[model samples]
Target: MKNTILLLTLLFSVNAFADHSTSKFVWSGKCLNSNCTRSEIEAENKANYQKHLQHIQDLDAEQEEEDREWSRQHDEDQARADALPKYQYKPIPETDNCVTRFYEKASSIIGDNAKEYIDVEEIKSGKCIFGFKLMAEEMCEYFDSFSSMATPDWSEAEWCRYRSELREVYIQYSGLVGTSAFTDAVQAERKAKLKPVEDKHHKIYQNLYEQHLKQLKQ
Candidate 1:
């Protein structure tokens, strides 16, 4: 009986030790598995965040470029509006006949039978078509006459006369561009705005002409 009791005690001790070792092993494995899963979740989260940041940066850059372009266009538009003189002029010219005559001249330049999209009768009679072409020609001819009277070495008196003629032409032209009758105040404003610009252009042209003349003589 004493031997049997000893054997039973030994057996119980071995079984308890085996059970403890197995439970420890399983707990270690569970801990390692949980750590691995957490690490994978963290890596995925980091990659997604990085991608979201990159996408936001790209969007910001695009918006910045769009803003810059809009600013540039707005500035250019504002400058143009500010530079243009504010003046009133009539919508149409004093005479439609002048428009007709100008068109005839332009037609002659291209050919007697000018290939126009619209017929002359349609224009001259103020028919249901776009505006007449004669107004453009008349303006051109008027400018031509004004240019002929002015010269590179013109005296102040000649300059004054030329300036006056150009002013009148500008007034009429402005009426065509804007919907208002040409008023004295508007004519004065146009003259002020155009005289310097026109003078500069004419000076450049005269200089080129003189250079050409000298080269020809040489």
Candidate 2:
């Protein structure tokens, strides 16, 4: 009887040890085996939390760098804008005596029928003819001066106005010569005679105009 009781007690002790060794417990609402400890689960949760925090920090740092870069670019653009030239209207001076005389004579001839009816020889020998020649020479000198400038002082509007003035001078000269009433063939001949001078001035004007546009972009 004593041997049997000892045997029964040993079996009960072994069963309790087996049950304890193989037992599962709840962690984070899920059952985990004995190997998966509460401390290990807590450590894993802490690691994940740290990883999340690091990710947020990295994103913040990237955003801050982008913002800084954007601000730097904006400042640079503003600086460029500030450094660019400001536009002011400057009128071309009408200081040439020859050009002034030509304008006066041409205006008078246009208004006076008797002056218009005068012989072509008389017209050719008049002050208007001499003034036109002087005006043409002055225009050529102006073109040379404009071409020699590294940066023209005139604004685009002033440049364009000067071009218009030159056109008006030619128109007035044509009227003075009575070419406006000439046959198409005679007009063509007159244009052909003036072509070389016109082309030379036109080339200079085009180069300066291109430079003006380039500076504006800058």
Candidate 3:
């Protein structure tokens, strides 16, 4: 009877222990359960919210950095563009037969003395002796007129021809005047006056040549 009573007591004790173990919750290390206190869960949730806010802040910072980098690059590019040489080229002027006008004026200035200075056979043979001036007075007058006139908006070819004629006239004039102190002084003064105008024309020609080359390449 005592053995049966002890057995009953043991069975009852086992059932009570099982019930107590199951009734009270225990942490499983996975998710929050009834075992978790409100304070613990709230703290965990606050930590997660902070992590989320931090992640968003990090993304915003990264985007801002990228935008700043892009802006910096754009500014650098613009600076380089501004630093490059910029040419303001004038529009090419129409052909006005300036070469013919230049020759006609020289011819008119030489009029009666044309036979003395010009070789008619040279003209017939297509040789360019039209620029020669045998008289100092005629040469002076022609040069003065040529220099005082404003630079024509002529084509490259016209400028080249005009310069050639001026050179021819100066050569003949120098030979006719010979090398006296007065003539030397006069020549020097004329050369000095002509230099700047010649330089401008030469620069224009260079620009035109470069522009044509670029067009050909295209």
Candidate 4:
């Protein structure tokens, strides 16, 4: 009877040990010290907290430096804008028959037989239409006689006169692009925006050029 009880106790102990050994282990990034003191843990947490604080401080300093740089750039950009001319569109010349003359000249370049799509190519060849940049450039120069006039070193009235002429030509381009269709959407957008963009750039350039002439005089 004693031997049977001892054998049962040994079997139960073995089973319990096997079950404990077979259980899965879970990792929790904890220091593998079951006997660690509370003071030791507190020391480690304090060190980690200090490192985190330092990292946050570093990030704040970096962000502050970036803000300073942007501010400097903003100031510089404002100065540059102030230096250039503030171009606003002028009304077309009110001379009698001015619009009539504009269309007449444009028609000669555009040809007598006009359509919704001005075969911009002037010369028709197969299905592809290449545009008439030369004619447009001539008209641009013609309309603004002061564009390349005397090295663009003109007085305020002269610049205003030039803008009036350019404005009229620009109006014609606006009408043409709006009314007519282009071979492609890209070409259409280009035609629409070209004159306006050029007008703005030329206005800025003219101001700088006038300043240059002043420097030469001084």
lDDT of 2 by residue, 46-135 (tens): 554456456666666787898899999999999999999998899998655533444444445445432222211113223222211213
Q: Could you tell me the lDDT of residue 181 within candidate 4?
A: 57
Residue 149 in model 1: lDDT = 25
TM-score of 3: 0.28
Misplaced by over 4 Å in model 2 are 1-35, 90-218
Q: Provide the TM-score for each candidate, comma-separated.
A: 0.26, 0.29, 0.28, 0.29
lDDT of 3 by residue, 76-184 (tens): 9999999999988999864445444444555677574443433222222233323333343334344445433223222424354546656765775565465564476
Q: lDDT per model, in order?
A: 0.49, 0.48, 0.52, 0.47
How close to the true structure is residue 176 of candidate 4, measured as C-alpha lDDT? Answer: 51
- Candidate 4 structure quality by residue, lDDT tens digits, 1-218: 34344544654454323323333121111422333344544454455445545666666678788889999999999999999999999998744342333334446654542222122221222222222232233333333432222122224334445555666656655645645553377466665666775677578768868886898799
Clashes of each: 6, 0, 0, 0
Clashing pairs in 1: 89-180, 89-181, 90-180, 90-181, 90-182, 99-134
37-114 in candidate 1: lDDT tens per residue?
Answer: 545544644554456456666666787898899999999999999999899896885455533554555456545533
